[model samples]
Target: MTRWLGASEVAARTKSVMKTTLRSGTGRIHFLLRAWRPISSHTSPVDSSDIISAVSPKTLQKGGDNGNFKQDFMKLKQPRSSVTTVLQSGNSEAQRTSITKLRRVVKKLCKSKRFERALEVLMLMETQNKIRMSPADHALRLELTIKVHGLLKAEEHFNQLPNIASQKASSLLLLHGYVKEQNTEKAEAFMAKLKGLGLVVDPHLYNEMMKLYVATSQNEKVPLVIKDMKQNQILRNVLSYNLWMNACSELYGVGSVELVYEEMLSDKNVQVGWSTLSTLAKVYTQAGLVHKAFAALREAEKKLSSGNRLGYFFLITLYATLNDKEGVLRVWTASKAVSDRPTCANYMCILLCLVKLGDINEAEKIFKEWELDCRNYDIRVSNVLLGAYVRNGLLDQAESLHMHTLERGGTPNYKTWEILMEGCVRSQNLDRGINFLNNDFAGLKCHD
Candidate 1:
């Protein structure tokens, strides 16, 4: 039986032949490989299959047969006299035309998702007439490689390009991908390398990282990034302010959330509108600070009155809490209660309280008649109210509500999920339980 070489063997063979022709190839390859460590981070039960595929032969190809390759190597081992004999007989314009055609083909390939094909074109162009891979070109190749096949093989191509000013930004993005698996330390090290190159880490980069950390609930990391933002003189955009505020709320509860509110409010250069108030209002309510929550609710309402009404849902909660039936009814009626209505915690609270008072008739009427009251809103409240129904053994209502929640562009969050899982256990909804257990809730993209 003929033994087939492993992927690494193929890559090594191809890389070896290619490296021999280029002076700085080894250094470039090393830098690229180190950069890919971020996104390919897997520390658990090591997977050999992934390794094999990562080191696959896509980035390399044959220059010649083994026998011919050895003969060419023997010839190349000695320095030849500097002669331009090819130009004396060959059509130079033909070579240029061929290279131009390859460029067009490669450009189109880049637009499509065929990364390996594009790399093939580049390598082929290089083989015909040594094409220098610019930093931008290398970075593009690295990005596509990682996006299509994972981070394993991206570095191989990345390292072949010389480090230049143009490569700086693209390099950071590649490094960002490396740390995409939430590897903070490695990402920071890569970020520092950019600093060594005289590129300051901007607030947007920090914000992007902050989002990743927040998703993993590493809320404590928010402060350090905030410091980086300040040092870089990167102005905080609305989203950055929102993210920092969110981090504060997660850690210090309402106190930190309020502090963010104060910070946003103090910035005359910045516009602290609906989203800021919306976030703070939600945090205050969740932290059980009804008074402070209502204060945020009022702040939202004032700003919204001048044509931005995104915070209408938050206001409904404050009104619902105080049992201000008129305030709730007034807003509901003013909108004709048909096409537009705010559906957040406040509305859900009203529904829950109405049910608690044995006013099932009115609640059902709202569910059936005031259908648009469940406008495009966050799904958390629906899940929360559903939890209340589950506790009280309101089976029929919970079932209908759950179905409606799904229908109205609401994907269940972890909180909603835990409640459903518990209900499934308590009510013994076996089919629902099995289905829920097997469901890929996290994969549900936001349609809203």
Candidate 2:
């Protein structure tokens, strides 16, 4: 008979086995596989694909995902080769005015992700006004800030620009700005504008903005959001329910979270997925309502057994949180049974978890596996491995990973600099770290 491991005993067992891999991008978390009693000794270590079937009597489909960013955001980068007109003959004042106008347009184009247009405007001014344009002037600072901090902060500064740029800023632009400010009033006002204009905010917008107000817990907006679905004729898609479900989980109980989901499920128009269920389950786990969480998982299993492999992962997370080693193993084995084609993220999570668990053997396996998987993902994966290696005191590996990141047409960000610098300091390799910062990072910042 399989050993029945209790919650309290999980930590003891996990002292040597519990692990969480820090994946590169996708949220696959490697955790303790509670039921996976490593039976290299057993002739059959419970078929992974079989247990997965036990959860759902449906079909099993295998696939892949974009390694770093979300699938919806993974367009490839293309280069532009247009030559610009130069403004070398204009007088100083005229040149400055022309350059300033060009600079404003450049910023506007950048905000719209129309980098080509911005560059074009800059070139046009340079060619016509006889003045030079510098991408260095607050361009990198603003660009980096927007990419790192996000569209919201960028919008504020973007909004201050001329009408052309402001017109280019979409609801995404405004929503991002509100999210960055983290100001409820601004967030609500912006959302209200979207609603007033008869536009339904996307799930992403609703979550970011709603998460802010959930703390107030007055939450009268709950029904209104649902009401907006009918009023505005949006079917309250999975993301819509998720934002509200997340809120209910925080303010009330799993019952509240389930209520919204249940309502959605009853509606023939609303289609939910395992991801939504997992997100809802997370709230229950966080609230210490494990029993209810389990029930929800079972429900998900029933609904999506033949659909997605996320069920096994959700169970792994739940068991990991509970410190249930056997349970974690069970889920891991089940997940693997469905497909061995793990994403870079899944490998990363497993690696981090093994590291945390001090299961170096498992961690090494994860690292090796991820090394192979990272090849397709380019710099993002390399950077993650570099950071992980540095944290684990593998200096050689970190250096190699850093070099690999550059080869993939991706520049290391400030976070990379800080992590490597700290790694160097710890290893007492100060000069090398300083050299990197001075020669590489500093030069990279020259554009700033």
lDDT of 2 by residue, 258-301 (tens): 78878877978667776677776688788888887776665565
In candidate 2 the C-alpha lDDT for residue 121 amounts to 41
lDDT of 2 at 375: 49
Please list the C-alpha lDDT of all candidates, in the order they appear.
Answer: 0.56, 0.52
Off by over 4 Å in 2: 1-169, 200-208, 211-224, 230-233, 298-316, 324-345, 356-358, 372-448
Candidate 2 is scored at a TM of: 0.46
C-alpha TM-score for every candidate: 0.46, 0.46
Q: Which tens-of-lDDT digit does each residue in 1-448 have in candidate 1?
A: 2222233442333343233324345566778677443232122333444332211121112222334332332232110110111112245554344334445545665676545555544443333334454556556656766766676566554555456654564666666675578777666776676667766545656676787778778989887888777887777777888898889887887777777768877877689876688677778777887787767766765566534333554455456665655555555444343344444644565566555544555555655553565555456656656776767767556766765665565555567657766776777656666555444232222211
Which candidate achieves the best lDDT against the true structure?
Answer: 1
